[model samples]
Target: MAAPAELQAALDLLRGLRERHGIDVVTTAQAARSAPAQAAALALRHLLPADLIWHIEGHEVLARLASGDVLVLGLDPSPRVNGRAVREGRLRRATIDEGSARAVFELAAALWSNPKFLPEIEPIGTLMPPPSDALAVPRGMEFVSAMARSDRPLPKVVDEVPTPGWLAPGLLGLAGPRRQAFERTVWNALRFLLLHELGHVCLGHLELGARKQRYRMIEELRIRDGAAPPKAGGLTDEARRALEIEADGFAAARLFGEAHERDASTGLQAGMLSATASALLGAALVPIIFHAMQVFSETPEPLSTHPPLWFRADAMMRAAMPGAGTGALLDAPLRHWAANDALQRPLAAAGHTHPLLGQWLGPVIDGGLDGPARRVLAEARFARDGLLRGRLRVQQQVVPSRGP
Candidate 1:
């Protein structure tokens, strides 16, 4: 099914569940105190659309929602808030380069076009980031804490901006004359995120009252009967699983639009330059292994959350051949998560109660969360002369040019 159509189906299911279960939902950036609410918020938020009213509340949250307003509970800032300010060296940089700007525009456009990505209903505003000097910039930072409200709302709720942490740094770091590679992948990630959030809001999965009330009622009934009561909906294992898969589908379709198959042939071309550059750098590291020990080696698990180190290498292999779809291109990094030792260990620790949860948590748990395409750009080297043809050749390994 079309991504938009599928998104609508998911929303319909959520709305139906809310009506049956009886709850008033809202979407917000607030942090919920209770573990259940936190999990619900996390899962529900992914299902909501970009535009929708989110009522953030803390004290008396469920009661407020039942009375009418949806209570959005914003989490307090991290306690480690070292109020101490540190000076950062000023570096004047372009707010956007041609390639990066184009990429952002495309991402926004895709989200706007896809119902699943943007959702049918949502709150007004765009998802952008706070300014910072962090190396990864907007991509990794929890930069999307605020939203921009729009006066006109109907078909679309949130006015999304693809200015998150990933786009800027990815664009800045790429080596090619044209930033075609970074643009495509960065836009894909942005679209995926926007649509996932929009799903929750549109679906009414974030509603209040009914969820808490049902939980209380279930417990009360169980006490009276001296037997377990049937489970109510909302935040159930099935619900969370459905929502995650829905978002993944939304992201996948958005990345590989309707005509993605037709355009699949170009995958190799997009990564040719990027692959070559990385291979050469890797080869260069081999020679200076001892001297460049620090540079050559990566810090072990917990420090790195990006997909496996070899992910890009695999992408390089796939991109060297023709007929790889956006899905295949994207899978290179996901495979890293699948292969992560940290994630496997956790599944064993948790007894794998939920397979879907394990899959979702793998990336974050194993520190395999890095975006492969974006990372390539983040590591791209800019030639001083900026030569059109003087770029280094990166194959499986970087080999020096044979001819003079």
Candidate 2:
């Protein structure tokens, strides 16, 4: 595939995805709600060839059109928000669901609250503490009663900045470097994801034999009712896996860019390396842990448009760093997520559904929601890091890392 013709085709696809995706783009307020994802797109945008004629949709998923245009789906902020404030000397409450409200408020905090939308951080009122009663309500109450007036008024939809444009930093529950780490992870993972799609476009697979079979296969998948069997149009699982692997390779290569140069006399290299590691694993977490997809099997993937998440993550590391081994890149991320207890947070938040969801999700951070990815990343670290030539190490037993 690296032969010149294939190479040029791939180059064209990459250029087409990046350049043609960003032409004459005008960003609207709603489109900017996905600041992290958009920032990732823009970062990729900055790296592309200047002559390319792509214009990014301020909102959309990654897709290439037959017309040579592209789309990157972004976050759309909720048109509505909750909380209360006294307006013209009256207390007003919003009718809202608590969970959804919390998630949106958290997102708003993670995003627009950061001061570094210029480049780096998340915030909410923690930058300044408002009384707990201001945000709190009687348990399970749909409408919140207003608290005594203070310098900072209660959060309301009207208070949200219109057209936050991703650059507007927001806050979460975090403080200090912990906050920075979360923001960096948010930005980096989304960037790596965009890179993977760019990889597909770059490899020219979208226009090539066998790989181009994705179009027909997509139509097959779209056949929701039991009309006809889903078809691969002669695209085997192996071939599809190869295409996905190639795309992941594209993402990994750029995701780890120029870390050594930053190593200089200063200590910036370490931070850069950590950020890159976050990107690689963060990309994997999306489909595996977050989206609740079926876990990858020990076998080659079945017919699908892409490889499984674990496979993609492992393939990506192996392709990019080769002999350096993938374990180095995975250990810290795996450990960090576990130590922070992040993976379980959602299941916990699910209330009554937590038990069934946990079983479905693979409760052991060592293996389940989708176990194979976590296991593979862990094993790669153990074997390559030389902790064990035999058996796998679970989250409970830490393999002293040579660390990702």
Candidate 3:
């Protein structure tokens, strides 16, 4: 379909900006071949209203793209792992870097290739109800065990693995059902990234951001004229953080909220995992991607625009599975992070074990929650109940549920 007038206008503006800045933007035809682009198309079909058209284009820049009333999302062709939604006048642009998609596949490959992390990565078969005969396949742990016992060398860490294009086969030497499972996990993670950006558009965040920009511009002009700036007025830091959380909630609900028992069987047959499994896997991988990208430190950044990665991951799990307790949802990611961190560090280094492994895994071994994990759960619960519940309810009333 041809782009809508407003969306095309926004694309033209983006085109001019890129040209003026000497940045090369990918052609639409080229972008359509990308995994992130394909994921955006599938997601938009379900998440967008029929009348609300959108377009995808790739860029060379590594920065997150912005969105507004117009819906022309951008994707970065580079391999850098990052995704975000920003504000552009009348344009709702959600940019996902190709690196982010590659990171998802790499993380899955790393976990699946390792014997220790197999159980954590492949909880679908064991944790969930068993699949029917037709959907049955070797569990990840089974495959890893076979590989370990065989002459084939186990898959290496991210640095050693020969990275393939997004969603390409032979990722870390995985194939067949195992490969499909990895691909599904990566695809769902991309969907979550896109959906988060769409959430900003759906929740009218572009409008709110535009209002703030206008206020800032007015205040700047007042200051330029030597007039005393009035009391500060615009989106506050707290509100910005709240919006990030709300967007996370929106994306989680849309991706995993409507999942049903049938999805396990049906999704497997269709080369997808159950929504619950997808949610858990995506949650585990997203933080890993963020850490790899150096987007933020493990510790909280008080002045940062987004919440801490752990906090965002916890918030997403809560939104996806509100009824479930804080046990595996948070523990799974912490475990995966610990394992990944261990593999990344020098083996001979003293005190090399991931701190989280000691803190989180020790408690899991003892059959209880740890102190820091408990504190994070408390904060996530408080935010969900106190800040997000009412806002989400109102947003749902205005935004249409995704299509079947």
Candidate 4:
């Protein structure tokens, strides 16, 4: 079926570009029947390639372009986005090939696919020492802070703590099947991300916004459709933010087929713990890590054109497992943990008085110095202690009218 008006716009651009540059969205079934041309276009929908143009014998599709009407572009390896589309009068050409977008997504996939290395510090989720006992932290928060930095900036955990060497070959590291598991995670993520760009282009986000390119981190940046600002080609950051949530819905639906919106219990409830499960959880945790990196690197808010970390992460998980609810809160397990006064006593006896420290204590099957994936499961708080939660809170206070 022809796409919606938004997606149909891409075809219009394709026709226009063909009129100007004699290029089309080639496919094996389409005009570009040559193996090389077909491969390049197929690659756009699947894997990322080093270069857009691949030399193929017995192919006249590209050879015919030797007349300088078309450019066979390659992927842009850098994941950091620095472009925005602007509308203009007349049939002017873009300074950069929109096809290069595959490169940026490929780069993001490579980063997210990387294994969790040893010697990483996990992010702090609502955990800290009281002002009265800041100097005398009985829990290892002080130690973690000291090890992470001599002059820690209040929050000890940045995005994640160092992956335990012990768990490297076992639970966390990309060893054996874990590597494959993580790769799958990256693949699913790429589908969501790349399709999102398609969503933007087809949705006509580029033509609606200012013709100037704007850079944003891959974590939050997304191609989206939104209400155009009042001024012609005037892109409002708020409008862009709203667009992200909409695009996320579009991406999630296509990535994960329609499932129940809310499942009261998922496999996690059945004590399903495996490298694959961890890999999936790790995939869910990726945006959170990148968001923390953005904070650490001090990326400005102007680049933030998407929903907050909590919203995005929650959306992904909820889509993946209906009713997962942000992946921050463990509904059933959390309830049991909260009610167990005995659990709190043991945590207190162990000098883990901070309520956040509850994340560290659990039974053998549940947790034992929870690994990154397990810790994610154990974490039952957002809005107050989450890295994004803190940011979201401040944002809500500042812009009291923002949507959840």
- Which candidate leads in TM-score? 3
**How do these models rank on TM-score, best leading?**
3, 2, 4, 1
lDDT leaderboard ranking: 3, 2, 4, 1
lDDT of 1 by residue, 248-291 (tens): 33333333342234344444243222332222222111111111
Which of the numbered candidates is closest to the native, going by highest lDDT? Answer: 3
lDDT of 2 at 159: 26
**Count: clashes, candidate 2:** 36
**Model 4 clash tally, residue pairs:** 16
Cα lDDT tens digits, model 4, 267-368, are 222322232233233334334333433343334552355445544544444444433333222222321211223212222222233332222222311322
lDDT accuracy of residue 113 in candidate 3: 39
Segments in model 4 whose C-alpha atoms lie over 4 Å from true places = 1-43, 47-74, 79-176, 209-232, 258-286, 299-304, 323-404
Q: Model 2, range 240-332, lDDT digits (tens) per residue?
A: 444445555566666655322232234433222244344443444333321221121112333254445445544433333312322323433
Against the hidden reference, what TM-scores do the models get?
A: 0.25, 0.42, 0.55, 0.38
> Per-candidate RMSD vs. true structure?
23.1, 16.5, 14.1, 15.5
Candidate with the larger lDDT of 1 and 2: 2
Error of 4 at 380 (Å): 26
What's the TM for model 2? 0.42
